[model samples]
Target: MSEREDFVRRFGGVFEHSPWVAERAFDRAASVGLTAGNVHSALCNAFRAASPAERRAVLRAHPDLAGKLALAGKLTAASTVEQASAGLDRLSPEEHQRFTELNAAYMKKFGFPFIIAVKGLTKEDILAAFERRIDNSPEEEFETACAQVEQIARLRLRSMLPGEDNA
Candidate 1:
Protein backbone atom coordinates (compact mmCIF):
# COMPACT_ATOMS: atom_id res chain seq x y z
CA MET A 1 0.00 0.00 0.00
CA SER A 2 1.06 3.58 -0.58
CA GLU A 3 2.28 5.52 2.44
CA ARG A 4 -0.90 7.60 2.42
CA GLU A 5 -3.08 4.53 2.41
CA ASP A 6 -1.05 3.00 5.19
CA PHE A 7 -1.48 6.12 7.28
CA VAL A 8 -5.24 6.22 6.69
CA ARG A 9 -5.77 2.60 7.65
CA ARG A 10 -3.57 2.88 10.71
CA PHE A 11 -5.00 6.15 12.01
CA GLY A 12 -8.53 5.97 10.71
CA GLY A 13 -9.48 4.86 14.18
CA VAL A 14 -8.91 8.38 15.45
CA PHE A 15 -11.40 9.80 12.99
CA GLU A 16 -13.92 7.21 14.07
CA HIS A 17 -13.71 8.45 17.64
CA SER A 18 -13.65 12.22 17.07
CA PRO A 19 -14.84 13.53 13.76
CA TRP A 20 -13.99 17.10 14.78
CA VAL A 21 -10.43 16.12 15.49
CA ALA A 22 -10.27 14.23 12.23
CA GLU A 23 -11.52 17.24 10.36
CA ARG A 24 -8.85 19.40 11.96
CA ALA A 25 -6.20 16.86 11.09
CA PHE A 26 -7.42 16.70 7.54
CA ASP A 27 -7.45 20.47 7.39
CA ARG A 28 -3.89 20.62 8.61
CA ALA A 29 -2.87 18.05 6.04
CA ALA A 30 -4.69 19.89 3.31
CA SER A 31 -3.02 23.15 4.30
CA VAL A 32 0.27 21.58 3.33
CA GLY A 33 -0.99 19.52 0.39
CA LEU A 34 0.03 16.36 2.12
CA THR A 35 -1.39 13.20 0.66
CA ALA A 36 -4.01 11.61 2.86
CA GLY A 37 -1.58 8.82 3.63
CA ASN A 38 1.20 11.09 4.84
CA VAL A 39 -1.18 13.14 6.95
CA HIS A 40 -2.52 9.96 8.44
CA SER A 41 0.96 8.70 9.15
CA ALA A 42 2.07 11.93 10.84
CA LEU A 43 -1.10 12.07 12.90
CA CYS A 44 -0.80 8.43 13.91
CA ASN A 45 2.81 8.79 14.88
CA ALA A 46 2.11 11.84 16.98
CA PHE A 47 -0.81 10.21 18.76
CA ARG A 48 1.15 7.05 19.44
CA ALA A 49 3.87 8.98 21.24
CA ALA A 50 1.59 10.76 23.71
CA SER A 51 0.56 9.44 27.11
CA PRO A 52 -3.06 9.62 28.23
CA ALA A 53 -2.45 12.54 30.53
CA GLU A 54 -0.54 14.30 27.81
CA ARG A 55 -3.48 13.78 25.52
CA ARG A 56 -5.85 15.25 28.08
CA ALA A 57 -3.48 18.14 28.60
CA VAL A 58 -3.55 18.85 24.92
CA LEU A 59 -7.34 18.93 24.92
CA ARG A 60 -7.32 21.19 27.92
CA ALA A 61 -5.20 23.70 26.04
CA HIS A 62 -7.84 24.45 23.44
CA PRO A 63 -10.14 27.43 23.75
CA ASP A 64 -13.65 26.59 24.89
CA LEU A 65 -14.94 28.90 22.18
CA ALA A 66 -13.85 29.46 18.58
CA GLY A 67 -14.41 31.89 15.70
CA LYS A 68 -13.05 35.40 15.74
CA LEU A 69 -10.42 34.38 18.23
CA ALA A 70 -9.79 30.72 17.45
CA LEU A 71 -6.30 29.98 16.21
CA ALA A 72 -7.85 27.59 13.69
CA GLY A 73 -10.50 30.11 12.65
CA LYS A 74 -13.06 27.31 12.46
CA LEU A 75 -15.22 28.25 15.46
CA THR A 76 -16.81 31.56 16.35
CA ALA A 77 -16.23 33.23 19.70
CA ALA A 78 -19.94 33.32 20.49
CA SER A 79 -20.26 29.62 19.76
CA THR A 80 -17.14 28.86 21.76
CA VAL A 81 -18.45 30.94 24.64
CA GLU A 82 -21.75 29.09 24.54
CA GLN A 83 -19.91 25.79 24.51
CA ALA A 84 -17.84 26.85 27.50
CA SER A 85 -20.92 27.89 29.39
CA ALA A 86 -22.69 24.64 28.62
CA GLY A 87 -19.70 22.67 29.74
CA LEU A 88 -19.92 24.45 33.08
CA ASP A 89 -23.42 23.14 33.71
CA ARG A 90 -22.15 21.14 36.63
CA LEU A 91 -21.74 24.40 38.51
CA SER A 92 -24.43 25.80 40.79
CA PRO A 93 -26.49 28.55 39.20
CA GLU A 94 -24.74 31.15 41.28
CA GLU A 95 -21.36 29.81 40.27
CA HIS A 96 -22.46 29.78 36.69
CA GLN A 97 -23.47 33.41 36.95
CA ARG A 98 -20.08 34.23 38.37
CA PHE A 99 -18.41 32.49 35.48
CA THR A 100 -20.48 34.47 33.04
CA GLU A 101 -19.41 37.66 34.74
CA LEU A 102 -15.81 36.63 34.71
CA ASN A 103 -15.99 35.68 31.06
CA ALA A 104 -17.39 39.05 30.17
CA ALA A 105 -14.73 40.81 32.19
CA TYR A 106 -12.06 38.69 30.56
CA MET A 107 -13.28 39.66 27.12
CA LYS A 108 -13.42 43.31 28.06
CA LYS A 109 -9.93 43.28 29.44
CA PHE A 110 -8.26 41.18 26.78
CA GLY A 111 -10.32 42.19 23.75
CA PHE A 112 -10.96 38.50 23.23
CA PRO A 113 -12.90 35.88 25.10
CA PHE A 114 -10.93 33.70 27.43
CA ILE A 115 -9.83 30.63 25.49
CA ILE A 116 -8.95 27.28 27.00
CA ALA A 117 -8.88 23.87 25.54
CA VAL A 118 -11.74 22.24 27.42
CA LYS A 119 -11.35 18.62 26.52
CA GLY A 120 -10.83 17.16 29.97
CA LEU A 121 -11.11 19.78 32.70
CA THR A 122 -13.88 19.97 35.27
CA LYS A 123 -15.89 23.16 35.60
CA GLU A 124 -13.96 24.03 38.72
CA ASP A 125 -10.63 23.62 37.01
CA ILE A 126 -11.74 25.69 34.08
CA LEU A 127 -12.89 28.42 36.40
CA ALA A 128 -9.60 28.29 38.19
CA ALA A 129 -7.77 28.87 34.95
CA PHE A 130 -9.97 31.84 34.21
CA GLU A 131 -9.27 33.29 37.62
CA ARG A 132 -5.55 32.79 37.29
CA ARG A 133 -5.20 33.97 33.74
CA ILE A 134 -7.45 36.98 34.07
CA ASP A 135 -4.59 38.82 35.67
CA ASN A 136 -2.16 38.19 32.83
CA SER A 137 -1.05 41.00 30.54
CA PRO A 138 -2.10 40.97 26.92
CA GLU A 139 1.31 39.91 25.72
CA GLU A 140 1.39 37.09 28.22
CA GLU A 141 -2.10 35.95 27.32
CA PHE A 142 -1.37 35.98 23.60
CA GLU A 143 1.66 33.84 24.16
CA THR A 144 -0.44 31.49 26.24
CA ALA A 145 -2.96 31.16 23.44
CA CYS A 146 -0.25 30.32 20.95
CA ALA A 147 1.25 27.74 23.24
CA GLN A 148 -2.12 26.17 23.89
CA VAL A 149 -2.81 25.92 20.17
CA GLU A 150 0.43 24.04 19.69
CA GLN A 151 -0.43 21.72 22.54
CA ILE A 152 -3.82 21.02 21.07
CA ALA A 153 -2.24 20.17 17.72
CA ARG A 154 0.24 17.86 19.32
CA LEU A 155 -2.52 16.08 21.20
CA ARG A 156 -4.58 15.70 18.06
CA LEU A 157 -1.62 14.18 16.28
CA ARG A 158 -1.00 11.83 19.17
CA SER A 159 -4.62 10.71 19.26
CA MET A 160 -4.45 9.86 15.56
CA LEU A 161 -1.46 7.57 16.11
CA PRO A 162 -1.10 5.95 19.50
CA GLY A 163 2.00 3.83 19.06
CA GLU A 164 4.33 5.80 16.89
CA ASP A 165 7.26 7.92 18.12
CA ASN A 166 6.88 11.60 17.31
CA ALA A 167 10.51 12.47 17.56
Candidate 2:
Protein backbone atom coordinates (compact mmCIF):
# COMPACT_ATOMS: atom_id res chain seq x y z
CA MET A 1 0.00 0.00 0.00
CA SER A 2 1.06 3.59 -0.58
CA GLU A 3 1.74 6.10 2.21
CA ARG A 4 -1.77 7.57 1.87
CA GLU A 5 -3.31 4.11 2.23
CA ASP A 6 -1.26 3.53 5.34
CA PHE A 7 -2.32 6.86 6.77
CA VAL A 8 -5.98 6.01 6.28
CA ARG A 9 -5.60 2.53 7.71
CA ARG A 10 -3.96 3.89 10.82
CA PHE A 11 -6.08 6.98 11.41
CA GLY A 12 -9.39 5.77 10.01
CA GLY A 13 -10.83 5.06 13.42
CA VAL A 14 -9.89 8.51 14.59
CA PHE A 15 -13.50 9.29 13.75
CA GLU A 16 -14.82 5.86 14.61
CA HIS A 17 -16.07 4.20 11.35
CA SER A 18 -15.23 7.27 9.28
CA PRO A 19 -12.01 6.58 7.43
CA TRP A 20 -13.07 9.16 4.89
CA VAL A 21 -12.10 11.85 7.38
CA ALA A 22 -8.50 10.68 7.27
CA GLU A 23 -8.66 10.22 3.49
CA ARG A 24 -9.82 13.77 2.91
CA ALA A 25 -7.27 15.12 5.37
CA PHE A 26 -4.46 13.20 3.73
CA ASP A 27 -5.48 14.41 0.28
CA ARG A 28 -5.82 18.02 1.31
CA ALA A 29 -2.46 17.98 3.00
CA ALA A 30 -0.94 16.13 0.04
CA SER A 31 -1.53 19.21 -2.09
CA VAL A 32 0.70 21.05 0.36
CA GLY A 33 2.62 18.36 2.26
CA LEU A 34 1.34 16.02 5.00
CA THR A 35 3.89 16.50 7.72
CA ALA A 36 3.57 15.27 11.28
CA GLY A 37 3.02 18.90 12.27
CA ASN A 38 -0.08 19.40 10.15
CA VAL A 39 -1.72 15.98 10.01
CA HIS A 40 -3.82 16.56 13.12
CA SER A 41 -5.11 19.87 11.80
CA ALA A 42 -5.93 18.31 8.47
CA LEU A 43 -7.87 15.50 10.11
CA CYS A 44 -9.84 17.93 12.27
CA ASN A 45 -10.65 20.04 9.25
CA ALA A 46 -11.84 17.05 7.32
CA PHE A 47 -14.14 16.02 10.15
CA ARG A 48 -15.49 19.53 10.57
CA ALA A 49 -16.07 19.87 6.84
CA ALA A 50 -17.95 16.61 6.38
CA SER A 51 -21.57 16.80 5.19
CA PRO A 52 -24.22 16.74 7.94
CA ALA A 53 -25.27 13.23 7.02
CA GLU A 54 -21.69 12.03 7.12
CA ARG A 55 -21.22 13.70 10.48
CA ARG A 56 -24.38 12.07 11.80
CA ALA A 57 -23.21 8.69 10.54
CA VAL A 58 -19.89 9.21 12.29
CA LEU A 59 -21.73 10.02 15.53
CA ARG A 60 -24.03 7.04 15.09
CA ALA A 61 -21.02 4.80 14.54
CA HIS A 62 -20.13 5.15 18.21
CA PRO A 63 -21.39 2.47 20.58
CA ASP A 64 -23.47 3.47 23.58
CA LEU A 65 -21.50 4.00 26.78
CA ALA A 66 -21.33 0.88 28.95
CA GLY A 67 -23.89 -0.68 26.59
CA LYS A 68 -24.11 -4.06 24.90
CA LEU A 69 -20.91 -3.94 22.87
CA ALA A 70 -18.80 -3.45 25.97
CA LEU A 71 -20.74 -6.17 27.76
CA ALA A 72 -20.35 -8.59 24.88
CA GLY A 73 -16.64 -7.77 24.53
CA LYS A 74 -17.31 -6.45 21.05
CA LEU A 75 -16.12 -2.87 21.41
CA THR A 76 -13.32 -1.80 19.12
CA ALA A 77 -9.92 -1.85 20.82
CA ALA A 78 -9.86 1.91 21.36
CA SER A 79 -13.44 1.97 22.66
CA THR A 80 -12.72 -0.91 25.00
CA VAL A 81 -9.78 0.90 26.49
CA GLU A 82 -11.59 4.22 26.77
CA GLN A 83 -14.66 2.67 28.38
CA ALA A 84 -12.49 0.71 30.79
CA SER A 85 -10.65 3.88 31.73
CA ALA A 86 -13.95 5.45 32.78
CA GLY A 87 -14.78 2.39 34.91
CA LEU A 88 -17.71 1.88 32.59
CA ASP A 89 -16.56 -1.70 32.21
CA ARG A 90 -17.16 -2.45 35.89
CA LEU A 91 -20.71 -1.20 36.52
CA SER A 92 -22.91 -2.95 39.05
CA PRO A 93 -26.25 -4.48 38.02
CA GLU A 94 -28.14 -1.34 39.03
CA GLU A 95 -25.60 0.92 37.38
CA HIS A 96 -25.72 -1.15 34.25
CA GLN A 97 -29.50 -0.97 34.14
CA ARG A 98 -29.40 2.77 34.56
CA PHE A 99 -26.97 3.05 31.70
CA THR A 100 -29.13 0.85 29.56
CA GLU A 101 -32.21 2.94 30.24
CA LEU A 102 -30.41 6.20 29.65
CA ASN A 103 -28.83 4.98 26.47
CA ALA A 104 -32.16 4.02 25.03
CA ALA A 105 -33.87 7.25 26.05
CA TYR A 106 -31.04 9.39 24.66
CA MET A 107 -31.08 7.64 21.33
CA LYS A 108 -34.83 7.94 21.11
CA LYS A 109 -34.63 11.63 21.88
CA PHE A 110 -31.81 12.59 19.54
CA GLY A 111 -31.88 9.87 16.92
CA PHE A 112 -28.26 9.07 17.78
CA PRO A 113 -26.44 7.54 20.71
CA PHE A 114 -25.24 9.65 23.60
CA ILE A 115 -21.50 10.12 23.08
CA ILE A 116 -19.00 11.51 25.55
CA ALA A 117 -15.23 11.17 25.66
CA VAL A 118 -14.95 8.61 28.42
CA LYS A 119 -11.21 8.89 28.95
CA GLY A 120 -11.03 11.47 31.75
CA LEU A 121 -14.46 11.04 33.25
CA THR A 122 -15.65 8.79 36.05
CA LYS A 123 -18.78 6.64 35.82
CA GLU A 124 -20.64 9.18 37.92
CA ASP A 125 -19.61 11.93 35.55
CA ILE A 126 -20.80 9.88 32.63
CA LEU A 127 -24.16 9.23 34.28
CA ALA A 128 -24.66 12.83 35.23
CA ALA A 129 -23.84 13.97 31.74
CA PHE A 130 -26.45 11.59 30.43
CA GLU A 131 -29.09 13.01 32.73
CA ARG A 132 -28.25 16.60 31.88
CA ARG A 133 -27.94 16.06 28.16
CA ILE A 134 -31.16 14.10 27.95
CA ASP A 135 -33.13 17.26 28.51
CA ASN A 136 -31.52 19.08 25.60
CA SER A 137 -33.49 19.78 22.45
CA PRO A 138 -32.66 17.53 19.53
CA GLU A 139 -30.63 20.24 17.83
CA GLU A 140 -28.72 20.95 21.04
CA GLU A 141 -28.00 17.28 21.57
CA PHE A 142 -26.83 16.83 18.01
CA GLU A 143 -24.34 19.68 18.31
CA THR A 144 -23.16 18.38 21.67
CA ALA A 145 -22.68 14.92 20.21
CA CYS A 146 -20.62 16.37 17.42
CA ALA A 147 -18.40 18.22 19.89
CA GLN A 148 -17.94 15.13 22.03
CA VAL A 149 -17.03 13.11 18.94
CA GLU A 150 -14.42 15.73 18.11
CA GLN A 151 -12.98 15.39 21.59
CA ILE A 152 -12.89 11.61 21.32
CA ALA A 153 -11.22 11.78 17.94
CA ARG A 154 -8.62 14.27 19.19
CA LEU A 155 -7.75 12.06 22.14
CA ARG A 156 -7.45 9.01 19.90
CA LEU A 157 -5.33 10.92 17.40
CA ARG A 158 -2.98 12.14 20.12
CA SER A 159 -2.26 8.56 21.09
CA MET A 160 -1.88 7.42 17.48
CA LEU A 161 0.16 10.38 16.23
CA PRO A 162 3.65 10.58 17.63
CA GLY A 163 5.06 14.01 18.56
CA GLU A 164 1.50 15.28 18.94
CA ASP A 165 0.40 16.85 22.22
CA ASN A 166 -2.97 16.13 23.82
CA ALA A 167 -4.19 19.61 22.90
- Using TM-score as the measure, the top candidate is 2
- Window of ten residues with lowest summed lDDT in model 1: 15-24
lDDT of 1 at 148: 53
Which regions in candidate 1 have their CA more than 4 angstroms from the true location? 1-89, 162-167
Best by lDDT: 2
- 61-161: candidate 1 lDDT, tens digit per residue: 33433222333455433334434554653456677677768867877776655766565766677778889999999778865754554444444444544
RMSD of each: 10.4, 1.8
In candidate 1, residue 135 scores what lDDT? 94
Clashing pairs in 2: none
Give the alpha carbon lDDT tens digit for every residue of 1-167 in model 2: 99899888877888888899989898776776544446666887898888889989998999999998889999999999999999999999999999999999988878889999988899999999999999999888888999998888778877776666734
